[model samples]
Structure formats: C-alpha cells, structure tokens
Target: MASSNMNIPSGYVSSASSPDWLNKGDNAWQMTAATVVALQSVPGLVILYGSIVKKKWAVNSAFMALYAFAAVWLCWVTWAFNMSFGEKLLPFWGKAKPALGQKFLIRQAELPATAHYHKGGSVVETAMSEPFFPMATMVYFQCVFAAITLILLAGSLLGRMNIRAWMLFVPLWLTFSYTVGCFSVWGGGFLFQWGVIDFCGGYVIHLSSGVAGFTAAYWVGPRSSKDRERFPPNNVLMTLTGAGLLWIGWAGFNGGGPYAANVVSSMAVLNTNICAATSLLVWTCLDVIFFKKPSVIGAVQGMITGLVCITPGAGLVQGWASIVMGILSGSIPWYTMMVVHKRSALLQKVDDTLGVIHTHAVAGFLGAALTGLFAEPTLCNLFLPVTNSRGGFYGGVGGYQFVKQIVGALFIIGWNVVATTIICLVIRLFVPLRMPEEELTIGDDAVHGEEAYALWGDGEKYDITKHGWLSDETNHDNNKVPSGVTQMV
Candidate 1:
C-alpha cells in the first residue's frame, strides 16, 4: 500500500504515490478477489452445468453460463452498474446511467449518499457501499455477481430452455429482478435502510436466483418425461471439479464483500469454509444413514447450500454458529429436497433441475433468518454502522432484526417471482421460452448443431462399431451412449 520504489521517471509522478486515496494492497486484493469470484461463474458453473446434465444437453447448459458472463459484463458497464449504485431514483432502485466514460471509471468509487431515505412521509437509515477502489474495479466486481446469479438460475432450465430465450432472459432478469435485489441489499435501497443484513449475498444472489429460477421453470415447463426420469450426470468427476472451484472460489466471494483486505474479510472467508465443510459432511452422513449409500450429487447440493447459508452471516456470526448454520443448511434442504419435494405438488410441479429451490432458496432464507439470531454486536459494528443491530442471542433489538430479515426476504421473493415471470412472458412473445419438441428430443445436437462430446475419429456419428451413439438414427432419450472422451481444454 505504500510507495517507495524507483520505477518512476525523473519528472513523472506514478499513481503509486501521487493519489493519497488509493491503497495499493487493498486495490490489488479487491481486483484479485473479483477475479476469483468470476472464475466461479465461467469455468466453474460452465463446467458444472455441462458435466451435471445428460450428454446431449451439455453444450447448451454450459453455453448459457458462458454467454451470460459476457452479456452481463457488457450490460453492466453500459448501465446496470449505475442502476445498482447510482443516485437513488426509486426507494428500491438507483437511477440508470452508463458507467463507461473514462472520467467516471478512473475516479475513486463511493457509496451512494448516506443521507436518510424517504417514503411518501418519513426518513430511514440506508445501507452504504464504501469500497476503496476506482469505479472500474467496483464495476467489475459487481458484474461478476450479476453474471453468476443468472448462471445459477440457469441450473433450473438447463435441459428445456430455448437458448435464444435464455440469452434474452439473462439481461431482462438482470435489469429488473437482479438490480432490484442488488439495490435493496447492497446498493443503499429500502431494505438496507431498514437494517436488513446480508453480509454478502445470501438474499440478493442465492434467494433471488432460487425464487426466480423456480418461477421461470414453472413458466417454461418441465423437461420431457423420459428426461425428467433419467437425466443422470454425464461426468461426476467433472461435476466434482466444478464443485471444488465453487467451494474454494467462495473465499473470494465473501472476502471481497467487505470491499477491503481487512479482518472482516478474513472472518468471512473462514466462516464460508467452515459452514460449507460442515454442511458437506452432515449431508454425506444423512445420505449414509437414510439411503444406506452416500450420493455425490447430494453432497454437492449440501456444499452449495452451506455456502449460501453462511453468506448472510459469514462475517457476522461466530465460528460455532457457522457450523450450526451448515448443519441446518445441509439437513433442512436435504429433507426438503428428499421428503417434502416428493410430497408437495407445488415442488413436484416445478422441475428445478439441480434442486436450486432447496439448496439456494430454502438455505438462503435460513441463513438470513439465522443471521438475525447469531450476529454479534461487535462484528456487526465492524461491517455496518447500524445501531443496535446485534442478533437475537445478543439480546437487544436483535429479535426485531429477525422479523426484518423475514420481511426483507418476503419482499425479495415477491419481487423476483413477479419480475422473472414478467421477463419470461415478454421474452415468450418474441421467442418461445422452451425448446420445440424436436429440439427437446434431440438436445444440444439439434439446438446448437454440436455436442459436448464427439468421437476422435468422425463427425456425423461416434463410429457405431466402437464408441456409442454412433448413428444419427439413434433415439436421443433412449440411447445409452458411452460418455465420450472429454474435450477438456
């Protein structure tokens, strides 16, 4: 963070020391943290999406994520960042403006005005974003979050969504649904003023994605019956590889939340790992006890839920509380996915391909609610300036914060459901949300004119005599093609 090196010319003053506002170490960490988070979306979700679905659906699934990453970045600088962090226009939103001008991008970043917010009648405390970096760094960091939220939602529609619809849906959802949550929780909007805590993005990212994904799934409808019945992963190893990236990459996710290289960032990173590990182990144990065989997929789901669960309180709660959150995140979501989903018509009706509803929605809500119970006053003080904002266990106004958490979630849930529905409906007018029957039956080969895997020898077929799925004549859903040699780069 200090500047003493002799890299400057005799007359030239380097930014390394000229601007007193910049902290070299902090800026470096923030940018690196943002890069790590971006990895979670690109190759992380991309690989996971491709490997977790059946062979035929792999390319489309991965492409959705890859495309979202680029699209969100373009839209982000053009206007979405300002919509998230610019001056407040609506109580729950910021004014839309481009963040692309060099003057704006080069300047130091700042939180929105700290003055009280107002309704038709009164004023309240809005949350603030005071990161110590240039506008370019802040914009890049937030864009990754926006991109990943869309990718997570893609998990729900991987096999059935029309690729064109998905391309459109990404921006629409980011514009309306995603920006709303970002403003509310992190960008100094209504919920922030109301003291609804979301240390990272348990609510803004996970809950919103979960609810929106489920709603979109309902609107787009389920996959073909045969696919719904037997959509086994094409490659569990690759799934694990992606899961590993998501797991380790989260250190950057929460670490960057504090927006500086500090104690809070360290705690957040530690809590993230603790919660995820406990959740993974607890989920594995339940599988062994109940199913008599531990399932890798179930473990990955638990890992994700743990990561989501601790996000709201990552730096706010104690280490022990992270363990408790992980246990509940693992067990409750597990039960919901296993028992209740099978029993509830509503859950059964929506085909959440990866059980995103359980892992994200259920666990995210649980984390937010628990943050109200376990948030330590001292820790709370470090993260935010809210008065009397400790959790219920701390015994003050904290219980009220619990109610606020639920209400805040209700608002987020309500907004995402309605917004996602509207976006899908609008996109439907121009493009069918679901793939046509022929495309659905043929999967990626029909939609993308490509497959996730192909033979080393040939193009049209996989060599019927040796490798499987050799003929174009094979029925995709029924064909038992051997998993192809991965074209991993």
Candidate 2:
C-alpha cells in the first residue's frame, strides 16, 4: 500500500481529488465569487447598458459591453493574466506569458510579486500571499476584475463609438492599459510594494475605468446632437434590475479579494452592503430635497458611488467608517454630476454618456483617500503584506499610509489617461473611433443591422410612413418619425 502511494503528495488524505494543499471550501468560494463578478459584467452591466440608453442605441451599447467581456477572457488567459500577476517586468508592469498549461493551472496560487519584507529597527516582518487554491481559480477571479473594468469603460462611449473600433479597442486596452494598472495595484507591482491600500480595486478597476472611459469619450467625440438632447432610458425598471445585480454581486467583488471564505471576506461583504445602503439613502434624500422628487436613476448612481468608495477599504475599516464614507460618496458624486459638471467647460465638452467620471473616478478617488484614513491597523495586518500598516485615523505611521494611497491613485489615473489616449489614437489610424454621421443618426440598426425592440408595424424596425406615425413636416422638414415615436426610439 505504501509503495503504491509513493507518488502521492505528502499529507494527502486518501483520494487524489483531495490534495493536502487544496482547501476545498476556499476553492469553491473563490470560484463562486468569480462567477458572480462575471455575472456583473454579462447580465448586470449588459442589462443596464441595454436599457439605460436611448432605445435606438440599446443593442450597440449592450454589444460593446458583451464584446469586451468575451475579448478580455481570451486575452487574459493567453498573456494578460501573467502580465498582471506574474513576475515583475518593470516597476509598474509584469512579464507577459500564457497561463493556459495544466501544470501551471493545478499548482497552488501564489502572487510572486506580492511577497514583502519589512524591517522596523530590531524587528523584521516578511510575508507572501499564497492562496490555498489552484492557479486556475486565481486566474479566473482576476479575469473577471479585468473584464468588468473594460465593460465599465464602455459606459462613457455608449451611443456613438464604432463597434469595429471598440472590438479592437478592447484587446489592445486590456493589453496596454488594464494590465499595467492591475499589475501595479493588485498584482504586487510598485503600488503594492509601496504599501498603497487598494483592498479591492478602487484604483485598479474603478479609477482606471473612469479615467479611460472619459478619455476615450473625448477622442471618440459626442453622440448625435438630437440623441444627446433627448436621450432617456428605454426602461427604468430594467435599469434597476441590472443595478440590483451589481449591488448584490459586489458581495463577491470585494469578498473575493482575500481569496478565502474567512473573516476578512465576511467583513468585506458586510461593509459593502452597509456602504451601498447608506449611500442610496443619502442620494435619495438629496434628490427629494433638490428636485422635489426622488429619482431612481439618481439613487442608482448613489449606490454605485458608495460601492466604489468602499471597495478600497471594505475589509480594512470599521462599519461606522463605511457609513461615513457612504455619506460622502453619496454627496460628492452627486455634486459633481449635478453642479460641478455643469460649471466645468472641460467636463461639458466630454460626452461621458453614463457620467462615469462622476460616479467612478471621483468616487474611487474618494474611497482610496478615505481608506488611507480609516483602515484599521489590526485589519491591515490580516490582509496587507506591509506590516504595521494603518490609516491616518489610527495615528503613528498611518499618515504615511494615507499619502501612499493618494500617490497610488494618481499613478493609476495618469497611466490610464496616457495609455487610453495612445490606444485610441493608434486605433484611429486604421478605423474611425466614432461612427460615421449616418450611423450616429440611425444608431444600432445602422451599426449592427439589428434593433433591441421591434414594436411597430408587423415586427418591422421603426418607419415613419409604413408605421403611419404622425410627424410635423412643416416644423422639422428633415424629421422622418413622429414626436411620440421619436421618444420611443
């Protein structure tokens, strides 16, 4: 019996299915977390984008997000995954390599660049993050994060970007922009080594997407003048459905950061919900007071901001601090979108369709900054490689930690801006970043040869004459469809 079992790993219980190094619970949880996060991209944001834009542009907007999710997966496994979590290539990047081999997949997951050593006068602290799960689990978990960032960026370019250009943009941006940010922040690049607190992805995913999305919107230009003036949600109820998924699915988004079903994950999940609820309430109150009526769209924005703000410190701060962060998240982003954006010429010039700059960029920066203030020392010890790390609120070396967080956010923002611009410019050399005038005017039907809804005239696409819709030909000589149909479109 002993001779027959010679090849089994040491401490192997009995069956090959149960390896000593593999913690089944942790592996299962990680996979489950990854799936929910993936859902946030596919059906979550996909539904949101599909229903939130002008009806004519629904199919194109959803397709952009769907295409990005699929494209990121392939690129992630082939090379981008390693460039994010493999050996260091530069201070802010990792070496590119394929992560598809079975030998590599079955091995225990370890972020080599995440190893750290600290010497405080007479004491030394050293640690490395080695999750008790196969590398496949880690790869899939990280891939979802990458995919969602690209999909989020699509929000800003929604009604007008060329599908062909966007298809190309996804893989290239994943390669040049997203990988660098992922490597630097979460994959143990310079920011991680410097002890910048990004407990989840305040800087990596939210901030990066917000900045890149805004920048891409600038390069791609605005939507049709008519659409921009009158764009309204095709279905607010469906938008809420997607928003609910995003809110619930975030349990896994932040929870999975620790790579285990442990205390930290539980804490993260709780904090996530607390912050989101607080922010939603605060946002609703503001809308009632300002507009004299609560706006569901505004409430969703608040929920998103709260979620983004808590992500960087979800497991590292107390629940009270989450409420504090939530209050600010609800207010600050609301002000930016409602007041500051209107006053700023630069903000007005960029047609960020979903206001990602306000919801993600501003909120993400606020969260990262707050994390530097509220991150508890004991909690930091549990997850951070840098020992003795604490937020500014805890005193001692906490001040330095806060500064590190801001610096980290700046690096991510600057990198995404430059990389996204370069990517857009490069793609423009081959294909137009914005669709031609006709496509912008016609929306999805012109771009994709399909429409999201066919409610008029024997299931045919919208038509003024065939559908017998009335129009004021004298008032708008060029207008084809009736005013009621225009609203529906």
Candidate 3:
C-alpha cells in the first residue's frame, strides 16, 4: 500500500500531496474521464437527440438535455453533491451540504463513513483511501453522474413535454430523487453498510433514471400523431457521433467509480470496452441474421446495454466474465425490446420515447445480478474494507452478495417509482407536464422559437423563411426587382 502520514492536517495526507507518478497519473485519468462524460451529454447526446427526434422537435429535445446538463450542475454544487456524498441523512440518504468556496476546489477529500473507509496494513488504510484530488475533481466527477441521470430521465418525456415544465423538473428531481439513490447505494447508506456492491452505478444511475423516465413519460403523454408514425432521424451521422461518444465515455463512467487511478481502474476500463465491443458485435450479427442487414442504430443500442450491464462489476469481474455479460445484455435487451414490448399490453399504452426501460432499467438490473455471480476476491481485496468478499460462485462467499444485490436493486426501483410518481402528480396539480395540442403539432418552433436545422440552399435562405425574416442580401436583391414589377404576370 502507498504510504501516507496521517499526523498532518485533516485534509492534507502525504500520499495526496506526494509527487508520485501513480498519483498524478490517476488524477489525470480521473479528470479525463470526467471530461469524456461531459462530452457525452454536451455535443454528443445533444446532437443525437437533435437528429433522432422528429425534425420539428429536434431543438426542443436537444435543449432539454442541454438545460438539464446546466441545471444539474447548479444544484450539484449548491446542495445535491452533499446529499449524495455527505454525512448520513438517514438510512437511505445523507445530509445536505454546500460545495462552494475556493477551499473545495483545492483541498483533498475524506471518505465519508458511508464510503466504508477502514484502516488496513501499516499504511493506516481506510476503505478505499487515496490522497485526495482537489474538491473540484470530486464535485465535477459526481456532477457528471448526476447530470447524466437527469438527461436519461428526459428520454421518457421527450416530444410532448413542455419545455417550461421540464426546466422546472430537472433540479427538483435531482434533489428529491437522484440524491437518495446515490446516497443510499454509494454514499454509505444502509445498502452500502449491508455490503451491496455497485462498482459503478447500474442501480443508482441507470436503473433509477430508467424507471423515473418511463414514469414521467407516462404522465407527460405521447408525441403528436404525425411524429409517432413517421419520425425519422434527421441526421444519422450525428446519431453515430453521439453513439460513439457514449461508447468511449463509459470508460470514465465505470472506471472513475474507483475515484482513484489504480490497476482496478485500468481493469474496469478494459472490461467495459470488452463488453461493449462484444455486445455491439453480437447485436450486429443478430440484426443481420434476422433483418437481412445490420443496422448501425441497433448496434449502438446494443453497445449501450452492454456498457450498462458491465457497470456494476467493471472492476470486480474478469475479461471472460465481461464477455459473458455482454452477450447476455445484448441478447436479453434485444428480446425485451422486440418480443416483450410487443406482447405487453400495459407497455403499449405509454410511449417511452427512446426505450430507456429496456436499455437502462433491464440492463442495469441484470448487471447487478451478474455482479453477484462474477465479483472476484482479488479485486475485492484491492478495494479495502475487507468486508467486501467475492461473489457467490467464489468458494469463500455464499448467496449473501447476490441477496444484497437484489435488495439494493429493489430498493432503488421502489424509491424511484414512488418518489417520481409523487413528484409528477404534485407538479401536475399546478402545471401540466404536456404542452397544448397546437404547440405539440408545431413543435420546437412554437415552443422554443428555434429550429434544429435548415439544410436547404446554404441554410441561410431557409432560416430566413422559417423565422419570417429577410436578410440584408434579400432586401437589397429584392429592391433591384423594381417597384410594383409584374414580370411573371
């Protein structure tokens, strides 16, 4: 273990202050991971939503994601961060604290009791201790997770959701719902105390987001009739870019969970990529076999499910285990989306815009279960606290870990379903979630006063017509047409 003298001040551990290459390397990687995640939501998913929605609603969908990204950050730094990572608030939450000031940016962090820090070896080790990076790093890292959760939830309410209602919902849900999941599962709540290991955030982020999204969408209603029937992606290239970003961004998504750079982080990054590639390959193969051709879009969805599936065990499982998880995730989610969705009369009533229920919720739950089967003793040992033993199949451990995984999953799903439904109903009492029918038909133009694209004759010409305005060139050119000229007549 790395040495660190604890006699120094509360926030100044020597390992954190040392110039060790490993420490610096890990910090750099963590920052990079954060940046990648940020990109996934910004131009990546933003463009993806813009292109994938009906042309008229492209701007609105993209704006929803963009607004969530910004709004979550504000709430994150102000209070949400403390709620998730702060001292215990309850069995399922933590006390709300502010994350402002220059000290937060430059200081190292102490692992909350909820993080399960325990002393180990001569190093005076705690559960998962490392010299802290600047508080800015912690805040930024956690903020990405928070932001993505909101973006994922937005998927369910797309198309018909009023921009004003959505703008109001992002911070409210993050504070009331997301903080609880993050705190309980990862912030050292009862679940963590009971040894529910979520290496990344399968249950906390993906499953919770998926459930909340579907519920919110149900309350918000569906898109216009024309949109539901003939909505084609405006730009497949943009969608591909977003898919690629999500694929690479997951390295940070899973790897950064360790919160420090180490072999575990490397292992997680490698396993994450392995699972995603395998799942994408499997999905493409199935698509070709069944549809006579592989769809890039379908392959992207497979990749996403694979990533979500490996999130809970990225550092704890082997390469071969990841491949197994990948195959299952790809195939299972495909079946759920195709067969189950078609046959389920209940699901048919609510239009889940992007099928987040299949990709995030189902994949997340499956990954959590697989973690119970595949977590390795070696990785668990490296993670500290020693309390985290290997998975069920590993001789020394029993069914306990699997049971813990199930308990955690159920808790998260239940919390989200109840909290989200309540939040929506309460909000509905004052403000309608869906827009007026006329606004729904007119789309982003009627709502945000914006259009996503103008792909005709250099774009400027179309833009002028759509917004009902003429540029200087148009006015000058028309002036040359002569007063009251009737040339065509």
Query: Lowest summed-lDDT stretch of 10 residues in model 3?
Result: 474-483
For model 2, residues 1-489, the per-residue Cα lDDT tens digits are 869777866555544555668998899999999999999988999999999998888899898889999999999999999999999999788999999999899888988877764532223355568999999999999999999999999999999998999999999999999899888887878787778889889998999999999999999999889978989999999999999999999999999999999999999999999999999999999999999999999999999999999999999999999999999999999999999999999999999999999999999999999999999999998888887999999999999988998889888889999999999999999999998998887777677766687555433433445554323221221225555664375
Instruction: List model 1 lDDT by residue over 333-366, tens digit each.
Output: 9999999999999999999998888889999999
Model 2 alpha-carbon miss at residue 215, Å: 0.8
Model 1, C-alpha of 81: deviation from truth (Å): 0.5
- Backbone clashes in model 3, listed as residue pairs: 89-94, 114-188, 117-127, 118-126, 118-127, 119-125
Q: Which lDDT value does model 1 have at 148?
A: 93
* TM-score against truth, every candidate: 0.91, 0.93, 0.87
Each model's total of backbone clashes: 1, 0, 6
RMSD to truth, every model: 4.3, 4.1, 6.9
Off by over 4 Å in 3: 1-22, 115-131, 384-388, 456-489
Give the lDDT ranking, best first: 2, 1, 3
Q: How many pairs of residues in model 1 come into backbone collision?
A: 1
lDDT of each: 0.87, 0.90, 0.80
